[model samples]
Target chain A: MFVTPGYAQETAPAEGELQTEIVHEEGHGEAGFPPFDTSTYPSQLLWLAITFGLFYLFLQKVVLPRIGNILEVRRDRIAHDLDQAARNKEEADAAVAAYEQELADARAKAHGIAQTAQDAAKADAEAERKSVEADLERKLVEAERRIATVREAAMKDVGTIAEETAGAIVEALIDRKPDDAAVAAAVGQVR
Target chain B: MAEDPIHQFQISRLIPIEIGGLDFSFTNSSLFMVATVVTAGAFLYLTTSSRGLVPSRTQSVSEMSYEFVANMLRDATGPQGMRFFPLVFSLFMFILVANMFGMVPYFFTVTSHLIVTFALAMIVMLTLVGYGLKTHGARFFKLFVPHGVPGVLVPLVASIEVISFLSRPISLSVRLFANMLAGHITLKVFAGFVTTLSGLGAFGVIGAVLPLLLTIAITGLEFLVSFLQAYVFAVLTCMYLNDAVHPEH
Candidate 1:
């Protein structure tokens, strides 16, 4: 059946042609489904081969590679960007750690300076207080020594005055002048 | 308004190109096949021309189809199966586009024929066998001998598996062809009912409404079938090749 019945294609003719079509089908002739027609197989296969082969070639060579490339580029870009982000974050973290360390060191340094200044001031005050105390003690000792010397001088005068007064009283009470040697001897015996 | 639903499938010669006395004339079927390729190719090529890092809507469709087929193959046969991506992608696109083209009014379904679908199925089976054998050598036969059959039933099971293995191409071809052929024919017949019913006077036109609605509904269902059949074909191809990739332990 290289050929289908002529009336089977694109046209439903009058009753006579329809009757002929039915008769051909009754004979199990070429009046059947169009795809089942073996006559068209080679042509269909040929064109199919041509078109499909061309299509396959086009895709394999051009389209698929382009798509794969685009996708790969995007994937690589994303991975690279992510890596950059991670590196930046690490650097930031290190910077923060360094800053905090510097801060801690400066704080300790300030504390040490304050402690040294305080100690220096306390030492200076202690030295000045010690010098003032020594001066006051020296002045007090001088004043005590002067007062002892004055008291000694006054005591000596008092003793001599007492002796003279006693001699005069003796002279006034006696009518005659007394002998110097005997008066002196009596005073010495009483002393 | 011809009652012959078979008229849509007629392959009229558009450009009769006979070669060396064999009737290799370019027909309407060939024209539509070209259309399918151009449509699929143009849509993909133009949409991805910019190769946008961030895809536009149409570009997303292209990428989605790529990932869709890629994921299907990858999932079925792992990364090793990516080698067959070009073939699988082409087959998926061709069948998908052909089926969709058939859905348009009066467009010839290139894949509606047994020879066409059978040829496609043979492409897959041939690849499965050729690559499977070329890579695995004699070990490729291990696909016929599954694991864990008892010693007594190993012979029986191996023969059964061999027959099943052989039937893969036939089944694959027939599934797509029959679905496309039968669905189109059924749609034609139902749509013909509207024509036949409306030809009668007033009341017949009114009765035509039911078949018209049915025809619309079936058309929607056929569109789903078009996409699904393509997916199923690709999935089965991947699975069949998986046998080649990692045979029974």
Candidate 2:
């Protein structure tokens, strides 16, 4: 049965060959499909082995490693750059914070100086006012003492003049001059 | 003539070289395989030659591709899985470049072949097995045995697990192969319809417009599929490798 089937299959391709010849002169003639042809298997396998083997070697030795390295290097470089950028940003943030702090400190120092200058000016004005008031008070006291002395002198002079006038009137009216000691005593008693 | 869509996938021997009775002929598939490597290598070298701290557009794309695979491995297998980054990354770039190149007109799609994809899948499987054995010693068999299994079902479950583990490479390789093959075949059939119909008559030409439009649309979808298939392949490989690394459950 197997022999009969094999013979029938061979005849089928033979028939196909005769028909194929009628259509095209250069027909491959009963070769059927190259893939089905077991005759060429060894050569095909050999070449596949050779080519694929070399291709494998080429990839392992040259291609994959180079590409792998490129990818790895790019990845590392990117990560490094990102890290550096983050560090720089942090530094910038710190610098800004320091600058703001210094700015606040400088403003406070300026305010303190301003307050101290204002206090010193006020103290100086207060001292000047006190000295001027003291000088004026001393001058007023001296003027009062001098005015009292002058008034007392004028009153004494007036008393002496009055006694002299009274003596002259009495001499003219009675033609007799009172005794000088009595006149002096009378003036003193009247005063 | 109904052109065979399968004809697009024929491998023609370009330079027949034999050494020690071995048929090591460089064929169209080999040419495109070399082209895929060269293009991928040039793309990486040119874009990364600058190694700019700030990458250019092309450089960014290159870097994104690297990180894309790296992240997938790390997520699936953790940091320890990074030891297999070169292998996983190589598989991803190779498949991705090969698939994208296949979308170009007249370019051979190497990954469409089962042999090529199976070989890649085998490498993933081998790596898994080798590493699992090396790291975990005989205890790696614990991967096939679940932690919480009833005594009656242990044999059944363990057998199923072993089968599933063994099937990884087949499924992984077939997924890529079938997707590429089916997509390319569909695209070719639709494209063929456009040509065949247009050649018939004016009425046929009018009918051809639909297929033409479909072909264009499918081409766009194919590009997306190409990238997705590559991503799936790489992601599945990572998961498999993860099982190898941590095989407890």
TM-score of chain A of each: 0.60, 0.58
Q: Candidate 2 has which clashing residue pairs, if any?
A: none
For each candidate, give the interface RMSD after superposing the true interface residues on Cα.
Answer: 5.2, 5.6
The TM-score obtained for chain B of candidate 1 when compared with the true chain B: 0.97
Q: TM-score for candidate 1, please give it.
A: 0.84
Judging by DockQ against the true structure, name the best candidate.
1
Model 1 docking category: acceptable
TM per candidate comes to 0.84, 0.81
Output the worst ten-in-a-row residue range by lDDT, candidate 2 chain B: B1-10
- Report every candidate's CA lDDT: 0.84, 0.86
Best candidate (score: lDDT): 2
Mind listing the fnat for each candidate?
0.56, 0.56
Model 1 spans > 4 angstroms off = A1-31, A147-191
Question: What DockQ do you compute for every candidate structure?
Answer: 0.36, 0.29
| Model 1 agreement with the true structure over A1-191: per-residue lDDT tens digits | 11123234434353344333222223233545566777678888988999999999999899999888888888999999999999999999999999999999999999999999999999999999999999998998999888888887886665555556656777788755666666666666666
Give the local distance difference test score of model 1.
Answer: 0.84
DockQ result, candidate 2: 0.29
